[model samples]
Target: MPLKIYNSLTRQKEKFIPINPPYVGMYVCGPTVSGESHLGHARPYITFDVVLRYLTYLGYKVRYVRNITDAGHFEEEGREAEDKISKKALLEKVEPMELVHKYTNLFHWAMKQFNTLDPNIEPTATGHIVEQINMIEKIIEAGFAYVVNGSVYFDVKKYAATHNYGELSGRVLDDLLETTRALEGQDEKRNKADFALWKSAPQQHIMRWKSPWGEGFPGWHIECSAMATKYLGARFDIHGGGMDLLFPHHESEIAQSFICNHVQPAKYWMHNNMITINGKKMGKSYNNVIKLTEMFSGIHPLLTQAFSPMTIRFFILQTHYRSTLDFSSEALVAAEKGLKRLWEGYENLKKIKEENFDLPDDNDLDKKINSLLDELDEFMNDDFNTAKVLANLFEIVPVINSIKDGIIEKNVLSSKTLHRMKDALTVYLENILGLQSLSQNNETFDGVMQLLVDIRKEAKSKKDFFTSDKIRNQLAELGIEMKDEKDGNISWNAV
Candidate 1:
């Protein structure tokens, strides 16, 4: 089946036909390095990481470009117009670049923990100043922008007259013009809808650069347009980010790129929905922004216990990317339990060796297994419905466990079918879904646990209740729960 992507621009799922066959270019808006990344930041990166992985699995060479906003990102654009990095640096009493390096490194560490693949090119906003300036000049020459008080602003009203300003975001220009909310630099703009291409730096601004519009930095929106054009060409396959950026940030990107390049920036636009904390929007004002560090360490007041990076990744995948995921201790705990169950089933499936050459004795069961395996790809192809894919994998897990526990006969499935099942499970779980074993020391830990299980089993067989009870009690004290299966086998997991 051909892959379908839900394009936010058109608000429909369309067949993904790359502009260049066998090669695809994707750009995702990455984190601003002014502060530590929070749970709100996890969704887009992980969602796009799976996209990158699945495309590669489908034999597409994808150049995934995710940018780092090391500079020019403002805190609530139009309200304050203060640079995020510069503001944070002043508070921390450090150089702007120093603060950027610290947070950027932390962001990379969090991504590594989540097992997200790095983008092919991670361009920084500050690093592409020349490209941004040239693009701004192009917009000016095209009469889509104007200069005021040494600052350049996009002529949104003019652009709207010639082109659909709200095509991507569905925002009407008339309403924006009527907005009475007082904003910084409102007097300088020809219309309230206009946004900055370059902001003239105040004397106290430490992160200023010399530009044709005097000494100042690039605007938040222009940074993305410049970097994406330079790396992914004037047009690319996909441009992805959180739904929050739909209005001004991404909408402005569309306007700027169209005016400068004379074409829309990307063929398809994708956005992951926002994350909420216990039904409330996650924000600093709400006192609910859980940083990735706080989440892993369980240092935040909202988190009941430390959550592993894989557990958080699994939690995010449980819901559709387009749906809002709510974070709570209860939801996270449930996700943790679910992940453990799925991992255990995966381990059991891997241990089953298909030595019998016999054909299926249970044709119905065999067909059911194959059907589930086939739907894995179909679900993924249908706009990357990872939630449905995971559901199907859970259904197959019982069949795998039944086979391992001797409830289902080995030769019931043909050798070909068994091999296919194994391959499909591995490909979907590890490769396409991008899940990894929870711990690196899992092998050694399992070996030790298995040895203990065997020792207890021998003691129980010899009718020595004392030694068996002692082993069981000690393991229970260590928070390891062991279940004695009906088939006289032992299964264990950490409680």
Candidate 2:
């Protein structure tokens, strides 16, 4: 089946046809690096990572470009034009780039922990100031932008006269012009709907660059338009971000890019829904934003325990990308258990070898297994419905477990069917879903832990209470917990 994706632009699911077949270009808005990334930031990155993975899996040469906003992002839109990075730097008593470097490295570390593939081109806003300036100049040359006292502002009223300014956002131009009231200090703009292309830097502003208008930095929306155009050409295949950016940020991007390039920036626009906490949006004002560091370290008040990156990834995938996912300790713990169970079944399926060749002893069971396996692709093709795909995988898990336990003979499935099942499980779980084992990835650590488990088992068998207690206590002190199962099997997990 051909892949179908829900386009936010059209508000419908459409077949994904690349502008250039056999090649796809994708750009996702990266984080503003003034502060560490939070739980709200994880949804878009992981969602787009899967999109990139699946496109490549389908034999498309995909060039993924995700930009870093290290400068010129304001604290709030249309309120005060203070740069987010510069304001944070002043409060922390550090250089703007220093704070940018620190948070950028931290964001990279978190993405690595989530096992997300790095983008083909990770452009930074500060690095591409020249490109941004050039784009702004072209907009001014086209008579769509005007300079006011050393600052550049896009003429939204003028653009709306000839073009659909709020098409992507489903907003009416008249309503916006009527409702948007000018703030006390923003009287320089001709219309309240006009947005900043470039802001003039004050004397105390640290992050400033020379421009025709004056010494200033690019606006939040212009940085993305400039970087995406430079890296992905005049127009790209897919442009994605969180749904919250649909209004002023993405709307302004479309206006600016269209004025400069004479065409829309991206062919398809995708957005992932936000992650909410306690039925409220995760934000600084709500006091519910959980940073990635606090999430992994269990230092946040909302988290019950430290969650592994894979568990969080699995949690996000459990819901459709377009649906809102609420955050709670209980929900995450359920996801943890679900991922653990699925991983066990996956490992067991991998251990089954097709050494014995036989026809299906049970035709009905064989057909059922193949049908479940076949639906994996079908679900994913239907707008990348990962939640449905995962549900089908869970249905197959019992079959794998029954086979492993000898309740169902492995010979019931032909060699070809068994091999296909194994391959499908591995591909969907590890490659497409980007999940990893809950245990540590180090082989030496595994070997040492296995040795300790064996030693503890032998001590238990011989009734050597002292040695077993010492072993368990020492391992527990090191944050490892060994459990004796009812089946006389010992398993260990990191605390």
* lDDT per residue as tens, model 1, 174-205: 99899836568879989888988999988878
Provide TM-scores for the models. Answer: 0.95, 0.94
Clash pairs, candidate 1, are none
How far in Å is the alpha carbon of 330 misplaced in model 2? 0.5
Lowest lDDT 10-residue stretch of candidate 2: 355-364
Candidate 2 has a TM-score of: 0.94
The TM-score obtained by model 1 is: 0.95
RMSD of each: 2.0, 2.4
Candidate 2 Cα misplacement greater than 4 A, ranges = 77-80, 360-362, 456-495
Off by over 4 Å in 1: 76-81, 360-362, 442-454, 482-495
| Candidate of highest lDDT | 1
Error of 2 at 455 (Å): 3.6
lDDT of 2 by residue, 323-353 (tens): 9999998999999999988998998789788
